[model samples]
Target chain A: MAEKKMGLHTIKLKNPPSILSTATIVGPKEGEGPLKDYFDIVLEDDLFGEKSWEKAESKMLREAVRLAMNKINLSPDQVDYFFAGDLLNQIISSSFAARELGIPFFGLYGACSTLTEAMSLAAMMVDGGFADITIAATSSHFSSAERQFRFPLEHGNQRPPTSQWTVTGAGAVVLGREGKGPYVTYITTGRVVDFGIKDANNMGAAMAPAAADTILRHLKDTGFTAADYDLIMTGDLAKIGREIAADIIKQNGYDITTKFTDAGIEIFDLTTQDVHSGGSGCGCSASVFGGYIYKQLINGNLNRIMIISTGALLSPTSTQQGESIPGIAHAITIERSLEK
Target chain B: MEKRKENEIKNIYQQMVQKKVPQSSLIKDAIFAFVVGGLICDVGQFFMNLFLSFGISKDDVGYYVATVMVFLGAFLTGLGVYDNIGKYAGAGSIVPITGFANSIVSPAMEYKREGYIFGVGSKMFVIAGPILVYGISSSIIVGIIYYLVKVLAR
Candidate 1:
């Protein structure tokens, strides 16, 4: 008989990886969010005393990684691999940080979804016994992303209401085979889904469908319903994308409206922040997960939670060529350690 | 068969995505543009009057006014005040000669670190290149047409 798999896309790890420690660093805007208290450091200046935004982002990521390691009483040399990514072209932020950290590095490119993508890979490495300890991290800066993806900041183009603000922050999580924390139980890798969304400004709409698809597939594969998990979080969907995702999932017979929340929406006080559609970036979900979600799990306030980090795979060249944005969402299920 | 399944999925996804497209307020944007644009024009007219008062010839006043406006626009862009105005005024800041000055200087300022030839020089005309090309080409075409008409009439 063939070994049974968990649905079509899910993987049930034989050795569950535990989240040893996590750290988050955010900009002034993100620091003003509801979960501000949970983050490790909140910089008053987005530049973090750096000359350029790109360098600032790299510095933030390095600091987050160091903080996470410090919390676990481990140094950079002790960590097996550093899995990191960012929204910048060629992921220079992560690459430059990796060079500084001097660890076995695996740079990822998942746009806004990079957090969960890195975590999923890190979990797999720990579970598969490939490595004992690994760090998963990602960062995004508003100034850097704005110039790279859209017009220059000085252009003063009126941002449409559909546009989501990129969170200027970084989050890092350390995963290991043994730890007194939440266990990464399962992972569901997603497929790139394109809905023919041509507007580059409205990233939430482009990535929402992928979030819904991954959520539905994850539920099916894991043989779990909406009620089974305390929370079902989608990364960077913000306000507009969250509603669209909820509707799509409901149409497929999964009504997770009450339990569903989004990192983008949760990161900011929408009314006070004036962040039109809310926050959307690799760091949006990463910081929220590392700071808020992990804390809740460790405190026993929540049990099982599934995070589906959504990414829009579009380059400047691709958008200029009039190609529709393709989105992907990677899901990871984390549960409070029963032994603890 | 595979292609058909993919298309079906694509159609459903597209329908769902279309529902979430945020609506833009046409009236508010128009009001901003109108007020901003009008104010910029008023500034230009003020400059024209100022030049005429200084005893500049009527024919030369237009050139001097344009020079002043362009210089002001570039200067404001460098000082970072123009961006704030742009934020509030929307098209008001962009639809005028100041906007043109902003377009060129902003990119040049941004790419200055990459060195003169590759960074600033190459990217300097990114936003204004097309406008220059079309503007010059159309003027030449109009000149040729006018010459042909004059010759034919004679």
Candidate 2:
């Protein structure tokens, strides 16, 4: 019989797909941040020699995909599938990058949760014997996101303290069916949760509950406690959301304060960076996982980790039309082999 | 039954979300707006004095000073400096004639990619359109009332 489905949303892969190589490229602000050394490329100029911020983002994603492929010594043509997404309208950055790559592409949109969503799908394809190797990638640019979601950079609009800076970067990971590396074991998909939050500036508050809900459901479905993993990372929830998520999770009978860390808070030093809340965006988690988390896993510094990336799914039109922001979180568990 | 269940879930979610929303300080925001707005007006006043010293008639000084200020605003917006000022100063940067200049130039620049006529020209008034409509309409109405009162008095 087929492998047992533990819970409604959880997927347990029988032959877990291994992450072969990963790459990250970040803009100057992100490069200056605490995780600067972890990134593969820290661009001096955000434009990256491109005419527009949108083009620059596409270039960053393409370069990340190339860099990841180079690390694995495999060409783009060898990869079976390419999954990518970004925060831009129609996800132009990913689609444009895919045009240059000339691969079988599946464009995804999960806002900041794109990384975990892409990773989960890529792992499923590899584990189900549908593909040998696949690549999951996502990107975001500060200027591009500002113009699309908030105000034009030229507006000089004041940002509230709760507002998080969109990290300007791209991250890519190559997953293979057979590899001696960190294995993706399980994935838990989250439902859309809207708590009547209408302020687009305060995304942390909007997405925190979804993060908590997913983490709780994943633990129950997989029969794993918070203590089971060395680290439990949430994508781009920043400081405020992280605290709220912790509170909700604690009330649900799981306390992950000691094990929990957020990509938004980890990417930037809140005290010094002037990023009022923390780093955020599709790139926030993507770059963090590719640059820092993956390195720790490969180096054996961390044995098991659960990444729960959260997203605030609000469009410019929706926000303007007085619609509350809906949030979603997707979780993936990756583990290192004991024998290795 | 399904509709009721959905409403129940939404209510629970709303309560949870309400508890987490960050408190925004009105006093702090107002102070930022006041200071920034005041500073912009000061710059306009400085320009007015400079124009007056140029020996232009006092009657013409108002027009010249306003023209200079508007030009400066547009120029700075093009250079991408005005936006930075707007960010920190918030409403302060926006309350002045300079902010009006920024509002026009910003959308024009953004839509420049779509071509001059369709993109830049069409979108130029996106932010300022409503303000212009009301401003001109109100002045016309006031003018009509003054004219009617004068005719009736005579």
Q: Number of the top candidate by DockQ? A: 1
Model 2, first chain, TM-score of: 0.98
Question: Model 1: per-residue lDDT, tens digit, A282-302?
Answer: 999999999999999999999
Error of 1 at A276 (Å): 1.5
Clashing pairs in 2: A156-B86, A156-B87, B37-B92
What are the RMSD figures for all models against the true structure?
Answer: 1.9, 2.4
Please state the CAPRI-style docking class of candidate 2: medium
Cα distance off (Å), candidate 1, residue B153: 3.6
Predict model 1's lDDT versus the native.
Answer: 0.90
Tell me the RMSD of model 2 versus the true structure. Answer: 2.4
lDDT, residue B39, candidate 2: 80
Q: Candidates' lDDT values, in order?
A: 0.90, 0.90
Question: Which portions of model 1 miss their true places by more than 4 Å?
Answer: A1-4, B1-15
